[model samples]
Target: MDEIPIFIAILSFIVMCIGEILAYYSISLKYRYEFEAISFGFIFGVATLILIPKSFFEGFEIFVVFGMIVVYLIEKYLAYCPLSRKYCIECDNLEEVIKIKFIYPISFFIHTFIDGLIIAVSYISNIGLPLYFAILLHKLPAGFVLMSPLKGVYKNPLYPGVIVSFGTVLGTVIGLITLKNISPKILLAFSGGIFLGAFLMLVPHIYEHKKEKSFLYLLIGYILVMVITLIQ
Candidate 1:
């Protein structure tokens, strides 16, 4: 079975923690739009430069679409669910409140879990370094996104960070256990789809709210990713 190196695992965990810490301290409602725009750009760049190319070369393009559809449906469900409420809101029913509160944190956990799986699988497949870099590059923005909604809701903001971190560890373990059966290409494609779907969902709202500034930031974010890719 393929295994992630101890150092790599540790480094990934540290980077994720750093992102969470930064978000906990720095993210605010005032700059939420800008943050979302940059996040969209980062995910776009990752999809374009890393995930799509890798998946296309391996003939797994269909899985990308499937992944996107999955996220779209999931987002729709979250949006329209009767039990759904904003993170900071209070619901009269305890069960419904718990369910509503957990929606985003659960999603964050799943996403980061896949991230861990991808990192482990990619490393085993010999494409670890760049993919790892790409994943690491986005961790900060991802942390912000994860924390933004849950920041004031949770008395200890560390809760969501711990959830995501646990997800990553579990994913790495699962990847190691299933290494022989899974294909990295398909995983990459699916992850790309999720990223694209998320970008599509988020960037539009940001564009509507911030117009030109959002566009400029989005472009800057994408360019930053490209520059990093070239450097790598």
Candidate 2:
């Protein structure tokens, strides 16, 4: 067989790609889900760093930026068909929501990059292969969870969304390169910055619609996922 880490590392991408399909199928399976799927993608970044060795942080940091682009593309597909100017019910008025209105169509791309790193880190972590496996198991759920938000933003099915998830390959390649030349302490500090950016961007979303039980739970899960990621 192939070298284990090398193999697992590469395999991670395949698992992620398959996950998107699995996620889409889940809706057909009829699970009650919120549109806030991108949130999981962000949390994945934080968790990836936490579980992996401190040394891998720099590699992880670079992977996140690239991965965000992947998420943006996915959102592009979801928003492309543009169904109703009316599905946006979360906000009190269109006037206030309009400022960030441009973001949803592509923001999901950012979310996936975070998710890619999260999956990558599990492979890198003290959680070991089993933890990695556990993470891969959630890939489908993640796909579906993420898809929910895009569905609401645009009634169109996610075509680019499928393409964007392919970024898992780019994410893995860059991360592997970082593995060869980065110092752990520096990486940790860098990771802190990345997570901070993602956290700041997402925290408000979680707080904005605090009324939804599912979203409230997602935030709790988000924080919990982050907490699990810190130095564990």
Candidate 3:
């Protein structure tokens, strides 16, 4: 059921975000906005893929982009698109559309397998608790923020959400395999990067919902992450 940890984990995220009063307040204030960086910093780290070919990294990078597309797909589901003429809003249209629009089962199986691998590795490594918390804290608002693009595409919301979830499985696989061998400094940096990206996704919501920003929630986010680290 995922009833136990799912809730606790979600609660932890709430607490963590609530706890950071300064950051929460900071987000609401004047100096609190960001523009999307239209670039990837090809960061040449210490101990890069000397043995691992450049092609492998290139392949994985392509896969990661593919996964993002899946995420975009799943995100469509989380948003309500009244203008969507794909299915009847009230009738059995949704079920019917879901049946026909769904791509090949075999394609999804391969996609899901990769996505599952990513989630499994990340969860097994215990970054999952924090990642889960991070995701829950941001998902609802993030969904709304994403509505802009989803509207542009004009598709059913549920379809994209499924795609995104499957993408996570793929990410978990790649993350797990490479993370272990990477330098400690790199791992720390990578984890921090993950947290940063999570926050980047959180920003638009924080801005849009400034009145609802909770300092305590931010504080709780920090404390809970620390606690999770201790447990791990």
Give the winner by lDDT.
Answer: 1
What TM-score, to 2 decimals, does candidate 2 have? 0.48
Can you give the TM-score per candidate against the true fold?
A: 0.70, 0.48, 0.39
Best by TM-score: 1
Q: Candidate 2 on 81-119: residue-level lDDT in tens? A: 232121233444332333233444244444444444444
Candidate 3: residue 43 Cα off by (Å): 22
Please write out the lDDT profile of model 3 over residues 112-166, one tens digit for every residue. Answer: 3332342333444443554444434433322222222333343554345344333
Please say which candidate is ahead in TM-score: 1 or 3. 1
lDDT of each: 0.65, 0.44, 0.34
Model 1 TM-score is: 0.70
Off by over 4 Å in 3: 1-128, 140-152, 197-205, 227-232
Q: Tell me the tens digit of each residue's lDDT in model 1 across 1-232.
A: 2444434555666766766777788644456567657757877887888777877754577888887887777666643233332222222343353553577677667767766776766666566565566556556555655565466568887776767766766777777667746676777787788778767766755666678698888887788778877886
